[model samples]
Target: MASLWSKISATLPLNEEQFPLQFSNKVESSVVERLRQSRQQLYSNTTSTSRMLNAQIILDISWEKLNTGTWRDVDKEWRRVYSYGCLFKAAALCRENPSEDELLQAVRTCDMGLLMGAAIMDNILQDIVRILQCEVRKSVKEEDEGEHMQVKRRKTASPHVPSIKDGLAVPRIKCPSLESFNTNYLLPLKPVILEGIIDHWPALNTHPWSIDYLRSVAGCRTVPVEVGSRYTDEDWSQTLLTVNEFIDRYILNKSQISPDGVNDVGYLAQHQLFDQIPELKEDIRIPDYCSLGEGDEDDITVNAWFGPTGTVSPLHQDPQQNFLAQVVGSKYIRLYSPEDTDKLYPHQSQLLHNTSQVEVENPDTEHFPEFIKAPYLECVLQPGDVLFIPVKHWHYVRSLEVSFSVSFWWS
Candidate 1:
């Protein structure tokens, strides 16, 4: 048991030697009691609707940021969050015949540990599922077996490939006056794929950013890279690597395939690479549409997203309106309106608050049944294509090939 906890702790973004997995009863009894009462109110001979209301009540407790800069920080903040999850799980086990509250409290207190951030793993999510125990979640998967099978078969589709679509086309344009773009799309929060807008950018013609070009330009620069199948995966980890080294291992090396027969992807996603490597800024131009914002051009933040084929940015929303420009290769993008937040089952964690818990490509219906009702718009962004994504819109992205994309974010 000790070894297993050690291994799990090692995977998390924390120093296990300093923050070892340990439990305390005296510290967490009160918090555990509150969680137990909340759980009992939810499951106690109540109608499903009533249970849902109580669950929402529990979730609605105001979550204030905790100061995690000292050893006292973990005890003051992280321990309570960890205990909250455990007690909620133990309460589920007493559903048939309610057990003594004190006995359950003792067990939950002994089982607690610290997780500094708001993120929780699949193992913890399973415990949360037991706590909420929503009825609709059970039927979600069985109801969509055919769709799941389709996603499984499509997983191996060639890189640069677009996912199967329902034939709805995203409006595309060659060029548009600033006035026209603002009125037709920007003001309405609608997405469009702009073409001629990026043709003049030096990235497309003046300089081809091949692997060699990237190495010569910013080879030694260190940047954060995400390693795993996707950010939503439990095994995902972020590491800093030089641009040259990242390209060599994840891109140039052929033996770095996963046991599942897919490439183990490393994505340099949403990084301010242009700022880090200023010379690289000369390669691209921001569109005139961003000028509609109140601030000057400097207010617009530029992010570089580079990755191998099969890399995915899971369903998530950004704070600013985004213009994602495809510089090198293609990408498959899906967008959902903010109105579908309820259906998307957003993660109940502060750090991941902007991210949806459901997997867009192959969502687990039993766990996120509401997702079945969320309508979405999708497009395949080809080289030089710029996609306008409104602020707070849920979007998912998958690289179709060895792709390099630059996104401009503005108010």
Candidate 2:
């Protein structure tokens, strides 16, 4: 236990000089004093649960202020407060001879801060969490080697292509030049299937993104998942689960049960997973075509979508240009031009204004009569295919098998 603590401690910043809480310039001196006092209380008695709880209360006060304004307008001091709280809790847990669950909780707390907090604070928690994850993966591998091998064998088998529904097929080009793509696709606002562009991605070759490899690296990390048939359903809700739990219940178990027997669906959709798990991010590369737009490379937003077959993303439109890259499995997609927006019948509510009321696959013709006449282009997105969708173009998607996709959105 002492050796374990030594390893954890070594990963953390050793002193205030290395990890200072210098928010006095950005916030009131009184607020800075409160943060300093709370940090001191944690270090004074690192194993005291009561002290940790008290520090959390102080941080929570700062956190509540963040919700009062738009995210970009919120004071940086508040984000730092939340980040510091996560770091304090992680350090306290490390001193108490923490269990595996405790370590995971600490890592998750830090990850939340990293995702939502300010960048001014030191990322001391990143190193601490990586060390913790490595230890957990070691134990998991020792116990589940046989199961892991079974999954690898199953995943390596060729994926079956399902029949795609009828619609005008989106045009496919074999890696068009930047000038050609901009002239024919980007400027014209036409959606096109790009081939030969993503074949060099490591995800398709040397370090393939297989089930076993994903479970090994991120099995213990916690992530948010959408539970229920699809987001359009009233029952649709979101919850957090470890990567292993999601794979076991949603991906692996689905294979064993009959399609009709399956009740609930879990989808890890539209998540910035790369920012949390840097290891998985290494497997992918952003398309060079993103540079054709006005936005800088840093302005691009990358999101991951992973789920089983039958998962649906109801007809919706996005505000930016999208490059949907399929890494594993396949999907059937339908696209309607912005000119058909009125026919598609968008929701009246401010929250769902971008989503159409009509189900693309099974339309309610009586209520949305115009939707029946809305012409659309469809395609079967296979492995290594990148579908370039113009801004505000209505699109509907459904997975044909257990799938993983990465989408890059830029202005």
Candidate 3:
């Protein structure tokens, strides 16, 4: 326990010089004073309950400010305040004889702060959360190693049944030289399946992303999930849920399939999950191909897509170039050239301009007669395949089975 506390304490900022309590000049004096007082009370010997309550008050002030303004316009000081409040709350929860639930709460609080807080601040909470996660994993492993190992072995040996689709297939090639890829595919604005590229990823074999492994690493962390069918539906909406709850309610409940198809599909789509959880990030490498564009590696955006078999991404065009890598199961993908955009019947509303009104699988010909004329390239992207999609290329995707894919977007 002492060792654990030492590690936690080491992650905290050393002094006010490292992490000042002062607010910007525009902030009211009373609010700044309250923040200072809260910090002071945390420093002094006080009951953990009192510390947590005081931190909650600070968090409430930050939350109110966040709600009042557009995210981009929100004051940076409030983000810092929110982060500090979470740090204080986590510290209070970690001290003395904290229960397992309290420790887990501390980790979750820190993750929330990291997700929403200013990146410029001294983010000690990230390191603290990492430490707490490791501790929790250790404790959990000791208690359930035998059970989890059996599950992992069973899943690791399970055969992957490929989904073969017949259509005008995307051209395929082995790993190409950067020059060849840029000249033949990237510059020509063509979509192609580059095989044998991601086989070396740890996610492929070393730390195979089995359901049990993912649950062990990130099941407790909260993530936003898209519920209902695809986003084009009137009932489609997003809700925050723990990864474990999402897996159980959506992924594991195969019996809940409706007559038309799977109902209530919950998709964790286009989320920068690697930024929130570092453990999962270490399992995969950023493709070197992302550097072929104008931006460097840091400018690339990585997103995780995990959902059940029937999950669908309505036809849409993204602004940046994309490299969608299949990691777990197969996906049936169809791509239409930007030249055929008019035929696809894109939504006119500015909010949904990038999305198409036509459902590729069940298109209403009377409403969208031109959709039938659009030429397309299609493929079943198996695990270890990387499909390069050029900028503003309209594409539609449907998972053939339970799938997890990572996409890197860059310009």
Top-scoring candidate (lDDT): 3
CA RMSD, predictions in order: 19.3, 3.5, 2.9
List runs of model 1 lying over 4 Å from the truth: 1-157, 163-167, 254-263
Q: What clash pairs does model 1 have?
A: 140-365, 141-365, 141-366, 160-400
For candidate 1, write residues 328-365 as lDDT tens digits: 87898999999989999888999898999987877899
Model 2, span 1-411: residue lDDT tens: 446667866765566546577765766677677667666764464446765775576567767877777888888778877777777766666667678777777767767666666644446666767877876776567777888767655542233344555558999999899999999999999999999999998889988987777888888777889998668788889888888889988887665333432258898875568877888888889999999889798999999999987778889999999999999989989999999899999999998999999877778899999998988898999999999989999999888788999999998
Best by TM-score: 3
Q: What lDDT does each candidate get? A: 0.64, 0.80, 0.82
Instruction: Name every residue pair that clashes in candidate 3.
Output: none
Provide TM-scores for the models. Answer: 0.60, 0.87, 0.92
Clash count list over all predictions: 4, 0, 0
Tens-digit per-residue lDDT, 75-171, candidate 3: 8888887887888788878876677888778877887788777653456777788888887777667655665565443221222233445668898
> Model 3 off-target regions past 4 Å?
15-19, 142-167
Tell me the lDDT of candidate 1.
0.64
* Models ranked on lDDT: 3, 2, 1
**Residue 315 lDDT in candidate 1:** 94
Q: Against the true structure, candidate 3 has what lDDT?
A: 0.82
